[model samples]
Target: MVQLSNNSALIFDGLALESYVSGKRSFMRTPSVSLLLPSPEGTRRAFLIMRNVTAINPLCLPAKAWQQNVAAAVRPAQLPGVQSHSGCHNQTGTCVDDSNAPVWQRCWKQVCQNIDVACSGARLNSAGNPAPTYYDINLLDVALFCPVVLDQACLDSLGPLGCTLLYESGAGPGMLPAAPLAVALGDATGSQGGGHGSATPLVVGVIVGGVVLLVVAVGVVVLLVRRRRPQAQTAKTGGAPFHEGLDSLGTRSTTSAAGTVGLSMLPTESTARAFPTMGSAGSGATGSGHAAPSTWPLPDANKRAHSQGSDTTVITNQTPIGDCEFDVKIEMPPQDGVAGACVGGSAQPDVQLTGIVLGRGAFGRVYQGIYNGQAVAVKLLTELTVDSADQACEAMMQELEVLGRCNHPNVVKVLAASSLDAARPALVLELMETSLDKVLYAKPGHLLSLQLVLHIALETAKGLAYLHPTVLHRDLKPANVLLRDPGSDKPVVKLSDFGLSRIRHSVLKTMHPEAGTPAYMAPECFDLTAGGLTHRTDCYSFGVLLWEMLAGAQPWYGMTAVQIAYEVTLLSRRLPLRPKNTPGGQVLERWPHRLSALLSGCFERDPQRRPAAADIVKALALAQQDLDNLSRRATPTRTAVE
Candidate 1:
C-alpha cells in the first residue's frame, strides 16, 4: 500500500505473471476505484501497477497476460512530450495516426483526448488559474523494454500527479529503469518547428535520452548487486525477495505461454452452472463441511458435528433468528391535527436527550434525549409522515421487522417504537455523538482517525453478522453509522437506519426492490429478482462505504444521483485518491480493488454466489485482526504506557 499525500492512497494486489511478458487478455475491464486529491489541483494524473504472486492459478493465465497488455499499452505514453503518432486530432490541433502507431502512440492519443475532454469549459479559481484536473492512467504490469520519461509535455499538461502514481514492474520480465525528469517546453503555444530540424525539440530529446541513460546505468548496477545477494537464491526459486508495494518487485512463474494452455483443462461449463444455490445451499455448505443443500430456516440444530466443522470456516449455519419469533401486527396509530404528528408524555426524561439535534431528515428532526438517565436519541416523525401515512407505516414496519431482532454491539438498539399514532410514531434509539459521515467528511480535518476507522469497521461487521439470519441492513453507508464522540481516542460506530432494510426468511426469501443511496447501492440491487439481497447487498454497500471512509468523501462523483448510479452500474466509475508523496499509496493503492473483488463475491448478480453475512463478518474480522497485529508489532513499547 502507498499514501500519495494527506488525501490520496493506493493498494496493489497480485496480477497474473503473463501480464508482464506475454500479450494476454485482461479480465478486469474498466477497473473502477475511488480516488481522492489533497487539493482540487489541476488535472491529477497517475499510473497504477499490480504485481506479485505466491501461487499460480493456471486458469487465470489469460487474465495475467491481459494485465500485461494494459500495462504495456500505457507505459510509452509516460515519455511526456514524446507523443505517439496516430490519426488523432485534439483541441490542441495535434493529430495522431494510431492505426499504424505503437502502443505508446495509442496511449498518447488517449491521454490527449482525455485532456481535451477534461478541460472543456473547465472553470478557473478565484486567482483566475484553472483548477487542477486529475487523470489516472492504469498500466497493469506490461513489461517495459525501455525506460519511460515524465516530462513537461505530460506534466505541464496535467499538472501534479495526484495521490499515488506509480510505475510497477513485476511478473513477466522485470521493468527497466526510467529517468524521471521535467521537460521545459518554451512557450508551448509557439508555432510548429520544421520537420526534425528545430534545436529546441532536439535539445529536449537529448535531455530525455541523457536521463534515461543515467537511470539505466544505476539500474544495471543495482541488478548486478542483487544477483549476487543471498536473496537471489530465493528469487530464482519463484520466491519473492521483497514485500509487495509500489517499490517492491512482484513475480509469478509461467513456463507455458498463455494460449498454449488447453481450453479443455479449463471448465467448459458456463460460470452459472458451477454456481451453488442461494440460501439453502449456503446453509448446507456452511453448517457442515460436507456441503449439502439446506432447507428453509437453516436446520443446523440436529447436525452438531457438521455444524462445528463448518462453523469454523463457514458461517451460514449460524442464524440470528433461531430462537426468536417476530411479533407482526398491523394497526394505524392516531394522529394529532398536524400531518403525521404523534405526541407522547416525557416519562423517560431521565434518559431523554437535551437541546442537541442529532440528525435531520426529509420527514422530521431528531433530538438528543435522556432515557433512564442515560443519553438517548429521540426521532419525531413529522406531519409529512402523517400525510403519507401508508408508505411511512410500511417503511416503519420494515425497519421494525429487521432491526427489532438484531443483536450486535455496533448496531444501534431500538429501545422502543410507537406507531400507535399516524402523527407521532416516534422512535427511541441509543444516542451516539455523530454519524460516520459527519466524523469523516463534515468536519475540517476530513480524515478518519485510523484506529477509529478500523474499530468502526469491526463493530459494524459484528452487527451485520447478527442481521444475516432474517434481515440484512441493505443501507450500510457511512451516513447510517453513528460515532460516539468527537474526541474519544477510540471511536465507537453504531449502525442505524433500517428504512430500506429487508427481512429474508428461508421460507419467505424474495428479491428486494431497487432502492438506496445511489453511491451506496450494490450492482446486484439493479436486478429486482436478486434473492441474495439478504446479506450480500450489505457487503456491496460496505465496500463502497469503506472506500468513502478511507478517501474522506463520496465514493463516486457525478452531477446527480441518477448519473452516479448509472456510472457505478455500467462503467464502474471510480476515482484514484491515493497521495503521491506517501508509501501508503504505493502499498495500498489497490486496496480498494481487493475490497471490490470481495464485494463481487457478495454482490453477485446471482444470490447463490454471494457469501453469507457471517462469512463477510469473518473475512472483515480477520482483516482487522491482521492490521491490529501489524500495528502492535510496528509500535514501540513504552514502559509507562504498558
Candidate 2:
C-alpha cells in the first residue's frame, strides 16, 4: 500500500519513494512529481526523464520547502537499510538469485499499484467524476513504462519485466552502474541494525537517494532555461486599446443596445422609392401619372414641391427646364441579369434600412433592416473609394454567387441585393439573433448544454457538406456561425459570412494567399504551396470550433494568432483534448468514446485522413442519441427531488 503524507507533498510505498515537487520557480511553472522504482533486472539503478511531468499532489507545497525536503532525502546517510542484494551477480552463468526474486516482485507490485491508482484517478476525473486525488500522468514513452492498456495489465500481473521486453528504447538495468554512495550507505545502515541485513530495504533507500539528486539537478536546469527564455505577451481581453485592423480578424468588440437600427431612422419613403425598380420601367411614376425612369438625377435640397389635394408625395428635382434627368445612368440588375429578378413585371419590394449596427466586419457593416415588412440583415460596403470600389464589388459579387448556390436551411439566406453604384452596394440577408462567439463570451451565466453543442455541430457539418462540391468557407470560426432565436429555449445555428469563401476549383488551381482567423486555421492553410485549400481544411477548423465549445475558453488564449499558427503548423502542438478543472472539462468527461474519436479524426494533421462532413454528421447523430438517453434517465431523478 502507498501512503500519502499529511500535507500530501510526499507519497510513501514500502518499495519506493515518490514525492511532489513545486514548479513555481521553474520555467513553464507546472507542478511536477518524481517517482523512483527499481529496474526490472532486480537492481537499484533506474532511469529518469524530466519532461512533461504531471502534478499529483493536492497540497501544492512551496518551492523552498520542496527543495529543502528533496535535498535532505538525497543524502546517503539519511537513507535507511540500503544494501546490495547477496547472490545477485553480473556473471556469465546467472544474474538472478532465488532470495532476491520475491523482494523485487513485491517492490514492482507496489509501484504498479500506485501508478494504477494515479492513472485511474486521472481518467475518472477526466470523465467528470470527482475523484479524491488529481493526477497528471505523462503517457509519453520517455517514462520507463508507458501506461498503455497491455503494459498496465502486465504491470498488474507482474509478468516478464525488462527494458528490452517492455520498451523499444530507454536505459536498462544492465547498462547502468549501481550508485556507490547508496550501496555504502545501505551497508552502513545494515551493520548498525544489529548486522541483520536485507537487500530490499537498503535498495529502496538507495533508489530514493538517487531520484532525489536527479530531481534537484533537473529543477536547477529548468530554472536556468526559464530565466533565459523570453516571455510571450498575451493579448488582453479587458481595458486594452483595440488594435487597428484587429477587428477584421474576427475579434469581438463592445456593442450597445443603442446600436440597434430601427425602421424610423431610414431615408424618407420618397427618397428610398426613387432607386431603380428592375423589370418595371414605370414603377417610379408619381401621382400625376408621369412615368419616370429608374435612373434619375438627385433633387436639390431646397426644392420642395407640394402635392395637390391628395396627400400624394411628389419628389421633383430642381433642374432647369428641358434638362435631361437621366444624365448619370446606373444599371441595377440581379446576378446573371436573370435569377431573383422581378418576374412578370412585378414591382420590387421596398427595403428600409434601420440604421442599426448589427456588427462590423473587415470591409462591411451588417445592419438590421426591413425587407418588404420582414426583418432582415443588411450588409453594406463601407470605406469604399474609387481605387477599392471595384475590389469590394467583386467580393460582393462572389459572395452573392456562392450564397445563391447554397440553399440549405443551415446556411443564411440572401434576400435581395442592390448595386446602384459599385462604391455603395448592399445585400439583404436573413437576420439572426446572435453569433456563437457572442453567446460563448458575452453571456457567461447561460452556458450551452451538451445537447445544443451537438446540435450546432451537426448543423455546421450539414452546411459544410452542402457547400463541399462548389464552395469553401475559408474562414469557419465560431464568430461566423449565427444563432437564430438565441433567447428561445430551442435555438438554431446557421452559417454566415461568406466573404472569404472560394470556389473549390478556383482554390485548387491558384495558390492564393492565406486568409483566415489564425486560431481556427488548419495546418495546410499556413502553407498554400503544399496544396491549396480543400474541404478538409474546413474540417480542421470545425474541430477547433468544437473544442472551443466544449472547453468554453478560447484555444491558446494567451498566445497571439501568429504564435498559435507557428506552433500548430510548424511545431505540431495541439491543445489538450480535455480542459482541466473547468465546466467544459465536466462536459468532456461525459463525451462518448465515439464522439471523442470523431473529434480526433477531424483534427488529424493529414488532410486526407480527416473524415468527410457526412461522416461527422452521422457520428454526431449517434452522440446526440446517447446524450438524449442520459437526459431522460436524469429527468426522473430530478423530478423525485423536486
**Candidate 2, 1-642: lDDT as tens digits:** 111111111212122111122111111112122222112221121112122222112121122322222222211211122221111111243222211122222111011111111111111123322222222221211111111112333223322122112321111111111100111011111221100111111111112221223354344334323321221122221112212111332321221111110000111111110111111122211112222233322343124232221111111111111111111211222345443333112355355555578998766688787765788887877767778777677677666655644556788877666643434577778899999999888766345777778888888888887666336687898899999887664678789988766543212322243677888888877763332345788888888888888778887787887798788878988776776754586664445687778878888776657887777888888888888887888676765988
Worst 10 residues of 2 by lDDT: 257-266
Provide the overall lDDT of each model, using Cα atoms, as 2-decimal numbers. 0.39, 0.44
Candidate 2 lDDT score at position 159: 24
Cα-based TM-score, every candidate: 0.43, 0.45
Candidate 2 global TM-score:
0.45
219-323: candidate 1 lDDT, tens digit per residue: 433443343233234333222232211122222111111101000011122111011111111122112222111211222322323211122221221122222
lDDT of 1: 0.39
